[model samples]
Target: MAGNESETAQRLIKAFQQFRKTGRNEKKIAGFNPSEYRVLFLIQRANENNSEMKVSEISQKLRVTPPTVTQIINGLEKDGYIERTVNPEDRRAVRISLTEAGLKATEQARKTFNETILGLIDYLGEKDSEQLAELLFKVHDYFNQLDNQ
Candidate 1:
């Protein structure tokens, strides 16, 4: 049983490593890398409900540190893609929102991401794609459980 488990583990490791090649040379998914686009998307989602995000809120949601979020925010702000404003209710708190350019970038990124994933789904077939998604979620859950433990 241990030998079989070792072989299975080796196969899983190789499969995970090999899967990195499917990223299209990793040239910025929709004009931004995964981290950047995800931050933009989060702000965009908040904007839809008339809410702006704080650094701490973003950090919590992204499961990263405040400094990391601030670094991304700085780059996005430098590019005029996002803005930080002083909160009216709390002078000490700053809130983040998407700028016009940020909105445009976010929309384009969304379109490209959907198209790519949809293309992958078409290639994978509906059933296999569905199964893959389920299995991936299980993998995610396993890691999450490990983290909690």
Candidate 2:
């Protein structure tokens, strides 16, 4: 049983590495990397809840440190994808929002990402894709539980 578990773990690790490599290559061809798209997605989601998002809020949602969030925001701001303003309620807090360009770029990125995933689903078939999603969710939940502990 222990040997079987070891083999399973090795296979999972290899699969993840290959998936990441493929994702990175695809993102490169698509113009925006996964991390950039994720930041854009998070900001867009936050805007649905409120007009602006705080840097700390983004950090929390992305599961990254404030500094990391700030770094990404800096790049996005430089690219004209996002704008930062002083929070009206808190003088020290900075609020972030997507610019018109940011929104457009995010929309394009989302469309491309969805198409790519749909292609993968077609390749995997409906049943296999469903099973993969369930397994992935179970893996995520297991790690989340470990983190809480």
Candidate 3:
């Protein structure tokens, strides 16, 4: 059993390395790097709630530090992809929202990411793809629970 577990761990590590390498090679869209795209994606998600996101919220969702999120937010703001306003409810908190340009860039990034994922799904076949998604989600949940502890 221990040997099996070790082998499984090794396989998981190799898979992660390969995934990271492949992700790095994915075609860039909207002139954004992967990290920038992630910030845009998170802001886009927050917009779905019909409310602007706070800097701390973005940091939590991205599992990054507040300062890191602020830095990214600063760049996005400078690039005109996002706007920040003082939260009305909390004077000290800043709310972030995507501008029209940000929306366009986010949409383009989403399209490219979707296409790339779909291509991988095609290669994996429908059934395997579904299974992979289920397994990956389970893994994510397991790690998430660990993190909360």
State model 2's lDDT.
0.85
Q: Rank the models by TM-score, top first.
A: 1, 2, 3
**What is the C-alpha lDDT profile of model 3 across 60-149, one tens digit per residue?**
887899899889889989999999888788898777889999999899989988887999899999999999999989999999999999
Which candidate leads in lDDT? 1
Per-model CA lDDT versus the true structure: 0.91, 0.85, 0.87
Q: Which ranges of candidate 1 are over 4 A from the true structure?
A: 21-27
Query: Clashing residue pairs in candidate 3, if any?
Result: none
TM agreement with the true structure for every prediction: 0.92, 0.84, 0.79
Clashes of each: 0, 0, 0
Residue pairs in steric clash, candidate 1? none
lDDT by residue (9-118, candidate 1, tens digit) is 99999988888766754669767978888899999999999987888998999999999989999999999999989989999988889999999999999999999899
For model 3, the local distance difference test gives 0.87
* Among all candidates shown, the one with the greatest TM-score: 1
The reply for model 3, stretches above 4 Å from the true place, is 1-9, 23-29, 87-91, 145-149
Segments of candidate 2 deviating more than 4 angstroms: 1-10, 20-29
